[model samples]
Target: MRFLRRHVDAVYDALTVRRSRFVRVEELVIRAAGVVPGLVPTPQEIAAEDGSIQRDKSGLEIDQGLFLSAVLGSERCGRHLCHAMLLPRPEAQALLAQFERDGRVKLDGASVHRAGKAAVVTQDNPRFLNAEDQTSLDGAEICVDLALLDPTTEIAVMRGAVVEHPKYKGRRVFGAGINLTHLYHGRIPFVWYLQRDLGYVNKIYRGLAFADDAPPDEFGGNTIEKPWIAAVEAFAIGGHCQVLLVMDYVLAERSAFLTLPARKEGIIPGAANMRMPRFTGDRIARQAVQYERRLDCDSPEGRLICDEIVETGEMDAAIERVVKGLTNSGVVSAAGNRRAFRIAQEPLDMFRAYFAVYAREQAYCHFSPALIANLERYWNAQSRKP
Candidate 1:
């Protein structure tokens, strides 16, 4: 509540102008994120004791909370969707800086390809079916950064790499979720969760792309404020499924399914706890998250999460068609209307309220003894080393 008061006036001032609300909101976010350096640990700082990774933190820093409070608590921005609260200057610049560093580091797990106005960002870690490790997550972060910065990109597409395995043959995998092997050994860092929220997922939902660029209305820039389409080939599990909730459209293969194994893993599945209810309503979202129900893309509940399901090997055609159709109308108007719908469907306060519960509960989930027990029984992390 105190945080709300400190930032409310600034939010009001920004929204008073026509299309400048996003700029104002972003500046606020950048300032907030910048000040929390000590609170925000890097991967190394919070890795588990065994030199691997596991969920283990009752977080003290509230980066998400501070930013959301300002945006949602302010009567003006809350009512207006803060002009889509698109990428702020600091967040975009941070990703840009990381991109420079990433090329030299060469994670090589993610890439962005631009063809004309359409761009595709792919996860390429084929060995683990594109499961997120520190490096792949870093790749995902930079890919979104590039897509957000590229002014030519109209409709951004996110997909995964295909690999030939002795076991699976020629199948392409979208994402296998988190790298549980790392989790079992306690190598996964707490910072991964923070970045997932503030970096990529927030960037996608808020429509932020280029830092400190002219508003899309003034310069006709591509802010990723337009639309995002996700193509899921095999399965989206746990954190991967959480990611789908943020996408504007989800396209999956006929056999693809989504699941949140967070209950079994004993960790919160990113923002799924909050966003899932918006799509599947309260009862259904609870069943999936709490009971570990698998949602097939073709099922009624799955269709709610995935906008469309295509036959195997036909995802490419479907993506092209959707991108062409969405872009044919010109993205400027679409961006504006998206903001309007966002304000109506999800006010900032609602999301802000959710984080209050999430931040506290997730910390407990991270340190739970049950997490290790479940991994041993279900994943056999002790023997299989996965």
Candidate 2:
């Protein structure tokens, strides 16, 4: 917990320094605060909000909360208070400008400090390797120095599962469910039918079906019957099978997660649709919708969906492959239409699998006193007024 707190404090300091690493934090906080609604605040708006501090002059000092509120606003607030406090900014505007002109952000010997130890992370902002950099590797390459505090190397490695794979290029895709689940299950006739038919039968079959090897009487019941019938009804009545038909539309074209049977389930399929496109291109959107198919590494469609699949059974190895691939290929080079889509899609699948495992682990594992204490502290702090 102390280590986590230190990371939070570091984020606050970095934001004040206007380091670009905090850019993500600033964006998150601003979005949480609902200060600008759908848009981000401009540099001018940020300056005005924070009492017109002179750019890069460092004269003004603001309370941590006030500074955060101004930059991130209230709408984007979240439980990750430390992250919200830090925002990433360009280290040097001149360098940024040059990168923009050259279509990349290149950094040299820039350090990412974590726990306490610092290691050379990379030599450059990998984004510099667009088609333009085909000949000149000397000027385009940049290096990074990473510092990890309290360095739990294993956890750091695990975290890379999310960070190393860009949403667009990875084979596994991860995403959260929209409100559609509640809408479908919580609605009127649907709820009644499910409770009466599927819920009751599933419970009874659990007790009796295995023992008798009999086809459970509740197996083909009303709940299943009605929604599917209703789906057809919906298509006829509303010109679509469901209010969230967009889910199916997205999954079929852009994602490879359909390779797993678990992902093929109706509810999760919708969530996959929403997240897949953010990683893949619009060209795949049409294909996903048209086919409503799931793809795997061995499938012909998988090749089209992702260039390479990290096939290691171990999660850590798979993630390492992704990180090495991205770093070596250069973030920018990997982010083109073809590669970026693959990176983006894999995480959604990984996250979905991870969460399922986590849920089961939570049900079985015991909590440490330190973890409980941290949870209590977090709840208490959240209970306090701002």
Candidate 3:
């Protein structure tokens, strides 16, 4: 551990002293991997000791986790990491320009449209049931940036695009969570988890952070933000369900459902652990995350997360009405109220500390053999193709 810390600290110190330009968690991991070989341990290292069932923390995988936790937990390093995450994506400007010119920017897996007073961002990964993966990450984040930054829009709406899956053909399915087939095929990188949470997902919750400003700590930090509404059509599973926790309001179809099967997936379900209990209390949250309890949208328990349940085909009209209602009162105080509520519930420091632990633990889980076994047993991952 000491040896690993020395290398990580040295690299961290160099970046600090050099005042390096902003880089996302994924970039930082790649940079560190270049300097420290085991920072991104090989599959052999993960297979050795059989995923450390004895709780032995001496593997290179543990070192990877420790190294990341050390960097993410640091006051200087972690703050910059968070700031980099909150900054607009590289293609954000172009995309925003296109949206302003054409009223929409449609990418491969996602798109954003201007609808009345709201910017509606749609997730459109049809092949995998609107699942999130590398192909969709940047596009989704950029579209989110456009949504909040658009001067013409007072609010933002998140919804799923019609998917092509045989079971739910031409139906709007919110998301299937992570791309397990990609994960099993070694296409999903470890940093993808952090990127999703710290980048677009966090942007949806806390808004965009400026480069010259102080860390957006919810107390006095300045940010460009707007209230977000989530329209859940079919179901929100795992990461997508976690997103509902951050939204200002959630509108779900009567037949829709929600789940956080972290135990079955062998991974932390983003920030659901920290934010879900606030809505459903700790016991039900535990049941959902640990025991795979599914919450039906019409049920009393599900209502805690979903604000209104509409008929299956009434989602479009419901979204339009809700957006009108939220903006009709004049949303001048929307961002302020969001910050006020956030301060009492979850300040920036609390979220940062939680993610510090999450970064390390999730890295370990990502490489654990149990994750592979769970995917094969539960998801039939081996039979599926990316």
**Which number leads on TM-score?**
3
Give the 10-residue window scoring lowest on summed lDDT in candidate 1: 39-48
Q: Per-prediction TM-score, please? A: 0.74, 0.22, 0.91
CA lDDT of 320 in candidate 2? Answer: 45
Computed on alpha carbons, the lDDT of every model, listed in order, comes to: 0.66, 0.25, 0.84
1 versus 3: better lDDT goes to: 3
lDDT of 1 by residue, 1-386 (tens): 46456755554454345435444433444444444444233333333243433434443234434444455555555534333434554444555555444432123678877755666788877777778876677667667767766666687888887855555457777787888777776655444565566556767775764434543333344455658889999888887888898788889999999999878887888778878998999998999889999999999999999998899889989998889888887887767776666667664456655544564455555556788888878888876554
TM-score, candidate 2, is 0.22
Judged by whole-model lDDT over C-alpha atoms, candidate 2 comes out at 0.25
Name model 2 segments beyond 4 Å from true. 1-179, 185-256, 259-284, 328-386
Off by over 4 Å in 3: 3-10, 16-20, 34-64, 218-220
lDDT of 1 at 82: 33
lDDT accuracy of residue 373 in candidate 2:
37
